[model samples]
Target: MSREKLLEVKNLKQYFKSGRHSVVKAVDGLTFDIYKGETFGLVGESGCGKSTTGRTIIRLYDATDGEVWFNGENVHAKKSRKELKKFNRKMQMIFQDPYASLNPRMTVKDIIAEGIDIHGLAKNDKERTERVHELLETVGLNKEHANRYPHEFSGGQRQRIGIARALAVEPEFIIADEPISALDVSIQAQVVNLLKKLQNDRGLTYLFIAHDLSMVKYISDRIGVMYFGKMVELADSDELYKNPIHPYTKSLLSAIPLPDPDYERNRKRVPYDPSMHDTSEEPEFREIKSGHWVLCTTKEFEQYKAEMENK
Candidate 1:
């Protein structure tokens, strides 16, 4: 399979100013890439800048430093409104909450058509209505429901509408910020399967951010584990699960519950203490193996490389 880079991020930083003296480094100099036609899952604990990273990538939040390149174009650099509008049509976001993300006052058709109108995808009113109806069916909703309000639908249906909205502009890349985290456990799988099917059919790339490791493993081709505003480990889903090298990555993996009752009972959770590592220097993200990447200090990087050599 070809591993063509669809999105490339280098030293991306998104920091929030708290006061004159304090600043919250939500995304502190992180870097990663999303391959074309691949879902790159980003899993991390709460308040670890996972969503912030997704927002930064989509240009929902302006970065304090670093660069984001999408298909060879630098997104963070200033562009004319026309250029920026063209960029917007190729990149879109699917927000986490189905309830809050959709406007309660707007009908489902109008909600989905917002992007279509902005991009002028449909030239006429009839065309716009037809496009919205088509999108509704594309996301598994009946065309009859296009005129209904968001409150009239279930959470899953609402999420499907959200997906349709994101798809309205025919975006090549999507940033799904914890797309299924707010959903019921039973509904999560349905949404994930829908996303996977859409990707297969549309050849869309995704930056799927979530806290659920098992779900991430199932849906993602590659996964990146983030902590405290930085990515610690990135590898193929199976490789990361089998050989998590960073202490933080190991801790996150150990928390995933197994399906087997016996294994679940015997599983031990690893606790991560960030203070144990030397935080004075900016660690380098290195490829210890052909595909596996990890962020580590000089000493730890040498140790990891040595261990990989032995293996």
Candidate 2:
């Protein structure tokens, strides 16, 4: 079944001018749509702007150019504080660092009530406290922990608190910027499972950003691979794992560890050299197959199509 697009990002560009007069093109000319009730994973290296893209979509960082339309409404354009407040309640973010994201001085109950207070969802102090307890329970935490601070919990528990905070607003769309990266390896799956359960129950739409390609594939229905500042490939999770066309995509796939010890030792890592591709002409994202998008120049796009056909 086809899903409806809840959010659309068109030609989004984020660039920062450095001291030397050179610009750091954090996210350049990227365009993609996230469907409602589905997880769209954005993966790449640390400096590839995966986080920047997520930040820009949520209006944490203003875009240098382009448009982000949520439910056909332009989010980047200026709006009254009241209008922006409504948007904020609908779209929430789960930051990457559990330790840094939460306020140490604030109790969990007060932290969760931040959104409820902003939107005036609760009528009184009693209702707000009840809402906070409900959110803690929803994220798999006990109600007794509500009085505790961020310093009392482990990394995994801290992330769960972050999740609870994002859910406090009862958002329709969530931008999870590596929510599980800061947690322990054993606890990573727990958080992922919680996110999946929340999606099933709440029908939440997500733009999940991560540098860990394997984790992204497991949670995301569709995945987009970004390079230094541009999207290089996008396709269904299974299709991308089986057939990665771009040099950067292939390199990323090759780096994932194999289960078999023998195979892992012998696996050849592909090095991505952007200079190999002809870039005199500006590259554009083209559909190389049904729902499979790739960034390439005119000649390279044709070559990619032919290569897929031969296979």
Candidate 3:
């Protein structure tokens, strides 16, 4: 991963009106940067605002506050129709559900070619067909399947079609919102491997969001952990796994089941207690190490520093 920042999210907030008087904060005060050519994994349990963060960054939802910068340009600012179209072509998203994301009525070829048509990437009908075929093959599908509908394919295959559709626009950055969670366990690894290969071949950058910590560590160069709509920790993948400073992070790490039978039998689960921290002052995101950050109050920050020194 280079130092060049491909995407930056600064104090982003998204709130929704729940009933008559309540407001639900789906994503609140998220700040991070994704370097060029790196996979930045955002992981947390369900309802942690992981998926909402991705959607807000991509402008699927209008941010309630703060800014999003993509390649040094503000993404949320009002732009002309042509500029928005250009922005759309550069940033594409692969949604979580393979079944609901695609149109059951459209054939595979037309589905993938929709972007190509909108962007006017191909000059003629022949060029469009050839481009669609190439994209289908790029995503592990053949031209023969192009004529088939979404109902004819399985979950994993439909996901590949979704991937093909995203690539049809030749996007620079992709927000993969739990792309593999809907597939079977056996098929999940296959999709991940394909994504890895595509990143290597196409020099793509990703914002990979999911709840599975082990799978995230496999593909992420750096990671950010969220809880209750706020980031609790951020660090390099290996460092975060080896030395988790936050209580919530430790609890999350402890919950990951290993493959070893003996280790699994002896493993201890750490239940996170939210009340363990001091509540006199609100916690802020502070750097505990050069690359490791944790949401902690001033007193906890010093204690964490001492804990690291003792380690």
In order of listing, the candidates' clash counts read: 0, 0, 0
Q: What lDDT would each prediction earn against the true structure?
A: 0.92, 0.93, 0.95
lDDT of 2 by residue, 1-311 (tens): 24788999999999999998799999999999998888999999999999999999999999999999998899998478987999999999999999999999999998889999989999999999899999999999999999999999999999999999999989999999999888888999999999999999998988999988999999999999999989999999999999999989999999999689999889999999989997779888999999999999999998999899899
After superposition, which runs of candidate 3 have C-alpha atoms over 4 Å from their true positions? none
* TM-scores for candidates 1 onward, in order: 0.96, 0.98, 0.99
TM-score, prediction 1: 0.96
For all predictions, the C-alpha RMSD in Å is 1.5, 1.0, 0.8
The 10 consecutive residues of candidate 2 with the worst lDDT sum are 1-10
Candidate 2 residue spans exceeding 4 A from truth: none
By TM-score, the better pick of 1 and 2 is 2
Q: Encode model 3's per-residue lDDT on 1-311: one tens digit a residue.
A: 57999999999999999999999999989999999999999999999999999999888899999999999999999578887898999999999999999999999999999999999999999999999899889999899998999999999999999999999999999999999999999999999999999999999999999999999999999999999999999999999999999999999999999889999999999999999998889899999999899999999999999999999
What's model 3's TM-score?
0.99
Q: For candidate 3, give the lDDT.
A: 0.95
**Which stretch of 10 consecutive residues in model 1 shows the poorest summed lDDT?**
274-283
Error at 196, model 2, angstroms: 0.5
Error of 3 at 305 (Å): 1.2
